[model samples]
Target chain A: MTRFRLGIEYDGGPFVGWQRQENGPSIQQCLEEAVAATVQEETHVYGAGRTDAGVHAIGQVAHVDILKEIAPARLMAALNFHLKPNPIAVTDCAVAADDFHARFSATGRAYLYRIANRRAPPVLERGHVWWVPAELDAAAMHEAAQRLVGRHDFSTFRAALCQAQSPVKSLDRLDVNRVGEEIQVIAEARSFLHHQVRNMVGTLRLAGEGKWSADDVTAALAARDRAAGGPTAPPDGLYLTRVVY
Target chain B: MTRFRLGIEYDGGPFVGWQRQENGPSIQQCLEEAVAATVQEETHVYGAGRTDAGVHAIGQVAHVDILKEIAPARLMAALNFHLKPNPIAVTDCAVAADDFHARFSATGRAYLYRIANRRAPPVLERGHVWWVPAELDAAAMHEAAQRLVGRHDFSTFRAALCQAQSPVKSLDRLDVNRVGEEIQVIAEARSFLHHQVRNMVGTLRLAGEGKWSADDVTAALAARDRAAGGPTAPPDGLYLTRVVY
Candidate 1:
């Protein structure tokens, strides 16, 4: 059996999420089905990130073991052909080491949150961006975001359903910048607690609106309670941009 | 009646075209309906350009006459509320002079055509871009695009049913640039014939593929026949970006 690593790009607006579920389709089930169709064998695909519903991914990584004797390019082409009508594309494929694990082997992961900071609602970028009607101060958001960097118990930012055993994770980078009418919040770390990025963005938006200061963000982090944090930003604007190994 | 000029943005995927038709919905019909619902009067909306089906717009200009006394921002907000679920937005609105016609008063227009030049298909931007699976030489395309930058008889690029009285239109700019994995073609002109930009892009793609050169493009332009030019590019990649008054 050969283990192949796949680079995936998907619009999560349609799927239930990354993991398999009985209520509706998920990215993992669709990918596994595509692989089964290509290799004519039941196989499991392990993903690097378990993105939530309505969350997109541009650089999602996955690994699958198959018994088919096909070229990586051929397998990728075939899988894409089968993944048709579903907004998912297998961009890259290569033979991976037998010990390679898509989740456990990943050393770093990055996320990008996009907010359309304008009075006019987004038409073309409707589902891909969070439309905040208020004019946001991106510089202030950046300044306040610096306070969240480093290791801390991110209980205020953690999701209730998060499976991570520890809430303390080291955040390597958290930067905010405005590109035209869109405000981009980029976060990088070895890993993240569930809903950490969205929770952080929601809290930073208060700072962008001049409603909260850097010291308030520091206090929220110190509180270590979800109630003290801001609301969770919608999953529509979140994108799993990269998973570094 | 007060004449109001509107700056509009829309995803043209669901519409028949900019003009009203019996077959299906149109952008003009939707905007007119929204205006009627807002002011309780039937009115006409004149657009700066008649964009084809599947073409998008970020800066499309239009005008409407209404009897209601309403602020521009309030009108814009009400129209947006009424245009719900449709991928259309009235970005800006302002009172206009009696003689300011949306179609006649426009001085210049700009269009952007995006091509995803990559092996993988676009997932997030599926309908918003044209996917070209081959590597394009953007510099070569840019070099050849310069040949079409002057006033010329463009019958070679004109559509058969184009209603323009003459095929002579001066093109101010035709530029090709590579942005990441996407090839962007920007065209600016006072006006364009039916499918002029798409035809030019189709021919330029040949140059990008190393199959044609600048001289070949000049020959095609000089032929004065649509059959001499390459096929028309898909409307999916075309976007009406700006309108200068």
Candidate 2:
């Protein structure tokens, strides 16, 4: 048996999420079916993260073990051929040791949130960007984002239905900047509870709109209650850019 | 009657072209209908340039004469409301002189061409960019592009069916630069022959791939024959970025 690690990219607009669900299609199910069709066996692929619905990915990581021996390039090509008509793509693939796990072996993950801070609605970038007709103070957002760039009990940002045992996680980086007409927020962490990055971005948006200051963000983090945090940002703008191992 | 000039933006994937074609829908037809619906009259709008099918626009200029007296903002909003569900928007609007015309009075125009130079296909920007799998030397492309800038008989790059009276138009600027994984080409001129931008871009692709040299480009321009140049690029990557009057 051979194990291969694959780098994946997806539009994420059609699927329910990364994980397999009974309700609708998923990136995981599509890959697993493709693997099964390629090797003529029941197979499944493991993903590094279970992204939410409407969340895009550029460098999502996954791993699959196959009974048949095949070159990494040939396997990737075959899998891509079977994933045809679907927006999912295997961008890169490599041989991996049997001990390598896409999820457990990961050391960090990164995400990017795109906000079109302009009056005009995005015609070409409708599904890819969050259109905020109001002007956004990206500099203010960047200043407030620095307050959340450290280890903390992120109970205030965690989703109510999060299954994680602990609310504590170390945020490695949080950056906000304006690129052209869009505001991009980049977040990096060892591991994150459900909805952590979205909640933080939503809180930072308050600062960008001149409604809150950096001190308010600090207070929300210290509160350690979900109610203290702002609303969750939409998933259309979120992209799982990379997974580190 | 008051004449108003409007700045328009659109994704040209659905239209046959900027002109009102009998085969399929056009941006001009859409705007005219929206105007008629807004003012309850048979209104027509004239455009600064007639873009080809599948070509996008960001600052396309147009002029319309309305019989009713209405504020610019209110008319813009009303037209936009009537233009619902279409991937089109009126970016700006202002009063214009009675003698002003959209096409005749235009002093300059600018276009942007996008090339996704990578292996993976673009999922989000499929129709908006030309995906070139091979490696592109943007610096070489830029170097060769300088040869085509200035007044000359651009017959080599003009479309065979171009309706222009003369091909001796001055190209003010042509620049090529790489932004991340994409290569951008910006072209500016007072006027252009049909398919001039696309043909030049197609020729530049050869320079990017080391297939053609700067001297070869100059020779093609000096030839002053349509067959002397390379193929016409797909309209997918070309965008009417700005129109100066």
Candidate 3:
């Protein structure tokens, strides 16, 4: 028996999210079914992050133990073949050590949010970006984002059903930049509270629109209340870019 | 009646090319139906470029004459509102002179081909990129692509069913460059023969793999025979990026 690590990529448009749910289809459910079909054994796969609905993942990591002695490469190919008709693909696979855990062994996580800051709605990038029809000041958004860096109480950005033990978390990086008509926000940290990145983006958007200033962002963080923050950004733009071990 | 120009963008995965056909839905058909639904009149939409199946368009131009006196913004909004449940979107709209024709008045065309030069099959980019598993040298492809630039008898790269009067055409530009894991081939011309860009891409892929040389490309163009070229690339990676008039 061997624990195998799989590097997964998927379009979240069709799935409920990364974790399994009784309400709808999930990425985990698809992968588990694919694994069962491949090895003829029921198995549970552990993922690095439990993303929300409509959120995508590029370098999502998962691990599953198999009773059949199969090569990781063969297992990956088999899983991809069975995972057909779905938009998911297993990009890479490797045999993992018994101690390695997809969720616990991870040291850092990185996310990217894409906002189509343009007058016209997104056409080519539909379902892949948050279409913000108003003009945004990317430079101002970047400046305001700096105030949210470092360890602080992020209750203003946390989700209502967050299962995290504490609201305090250290943000290693938070950058806002413009690439043509798209405004991109990149965030990296050891972990994040549910909807933390999206909530921060929603608040930062007000600064981008000339509604709020950097000082206002500082005030929101100091309040440490969910009501103090701006509206939560939609999941259409959130992408789990990477998970570092 | 007023002639209006529309800038369109669509994911071609769900269309049978850009022209209206009885086989299935097309981008042109979608626009015409939307126009009928909006202006309360049946109208014919003329397109600047007729893209193929599975080919995307980021900046496709089209024109239609409307009997209703609707503002350009209002007409655009109305058409977009009716184009729902489809991947097609009207990005921009403008009032054009009655003499202007989307097909005939167009003086320049630009196309972009995307090749995912990676080992893994696309996940998020599924149906959006041509995944090339083999290693490709973009610089070598660029070098060979230059040989096919300028005016030439491009019958070697023409399709079997092309309706152009002559195969001789001028290529304004052809560039190959790698952006991280993706290699992009950009082509510009007053107009192109059917399958010209895809044929050039297929031939360039051979050069990228060290199968063909720059001299071979020059020789192929001089042959003026469709069988002399390498092969036609799949439409998945091809995109009609711009139509300049």
Candidate 4:
């Protein structure tokens, strides 16, 4: 058996997150089904991260083990041929050693959140970005985000249903910037708690709208309670940009 | 009556085109109906350009005369409130001179065409970009595009159903550039013939794929016959980016 690494891009609007669930369809199920159809073998696929529903991914990484002797390029072509009509594409494929674990061997992950800070709702970017009518102070949001960029116990940003054993994680970067009427927030980390990025974005949005200050964000971190954090931002604005190895 | 200039944005996946077509719903009909509902009056809105079916717009400009004495901001909000559920947005609105005409008074129009040069079909940008499986030489495409720049008779590229009286039009700029796996072609002119941009892109694709050479593009241009040009590209990848007055 040969193991293969795949680079995936998907529109997560129609999916119920990456992991297979009884609730609805998932990116994992789609990939596995495509692979099964191509190789005529029922196989399981593993992804580096299981994104939430309505969360997009441009460079999601996955690994699958198959007994087929097809080349990497042909495998990519055959898989894409079967995955048609669905908003999922395997952009790249490569042979990997059996030791390469898509989830365990990953070193970092990057995320991007987009906020359209204008009166009109997004048109071309519909279902892809958050629409905030009032103008946001991106500089203030940046200042607030800087306060959380370090190794810390991010209990305030952790979701109540988060299954992670600990909230302690190292945040490598958190940046906020504005371009025209759109505000972009970029975050990077070795790992994240459930809804951690979205919760932090919600709090930064409050600072952007002048409802809260940087000190308030600091206080929320100190509170170490889920209620202390701001509301969770919708999944529409979030994108799993890349998974670094 | 006050005339207002509005900058519009829309995803063209649903609409037939920008014009009022009898076959299917059009962006013009959607916007007009939304505006009429908001102001309680019938209004004829004119757009600076009429994009084809499946062609998107990011900064399409339009003008409408309304009898209501409402502020531009309020008008924008009300129209958007009614235009909801449809992927159409009035991004900006301003009071314009009564003499302002959306089509005639426009001094420049800019368009962008995107091509995903990769083996796999696009997932995230499925409708937003054209997916070509063959390897593309962007440098060759750029060189071929330069041959079509400046004033010339673009009969080889114009659609047979084009309403323009003359095939001669000044071509201000046509630039082709590659960004990672994407190829972006930007075109600017005061006006264009129907299917001109798509036709040009189609011919350039042939050149980029080694099916045709730069000299072939020049020969096709000099032929001055629609049959001499390459196949017309689909409208999905075209975008009416901006209209400058």
lDDT over C-alpha atoms for residue A238 of model 3: 91
Return the top candidate by DockQ: 4
State the lDDT of candidate 1 residue by residue for B30-146, as single tens digits.
999999999999999999999998899999999999998999999999999999889999999999999999999999999999999988889999999999999999999999999
The deviation in Å at residue B211 for candidate 3 is 3.4
lDDT digits (tens) for residues B163-243 of candidate 4: 999999898999999999999999999999999999999999998999998899999999999999999988888999999
TM-score of every prediction relative to native: 0.99, 0.93, 0.94, 0.98
**Model 4 TM:** 0.98
What is the alpha-carbon lDDT for the whole of candidate 2? 0.92
Tens-place lDDT per residue, model 1, A1-245, is 89999999999999999999998999999999999889899998999999999899999999999986999999999999989989999999999999999999999999999999987899999899999999999999999999999999999999999999999999999999999999999999999999999999999999999999999999999999999999999999999999999
TM-score of the first chain alone, every candidate = 0.99, 0.98, 0.99, 0.99
Give the whole-model CA lDDT for all candidates, comma-separated: 0.96, 0.92, 0.93, 0.93
Give the per-residue Cα lDDT of candidate 1 at A75: 96
Off by over 4 Å in 1: none
lDDT of 1: 0.96
Model 3 lDDT tens row, A121-185: 77677888998988999999999999999999999999989999999999999999999989999
Model 3 C-alpha lDDT versus the unseen true structure: 0.93
lDDT of 3 by residue, B124-191 (tens): 88788888879999999999999999999999999999999999999999999999989999999999
Q: Enumerate residue pairs that collide in model 1.
A: none
Clashes (candidate 2) = 0
Range of the 10 consecutive residues with the lowest summed lDDT in candidate 4 chain A: A119-128
Better of 1 and 2 by DockQ: 1
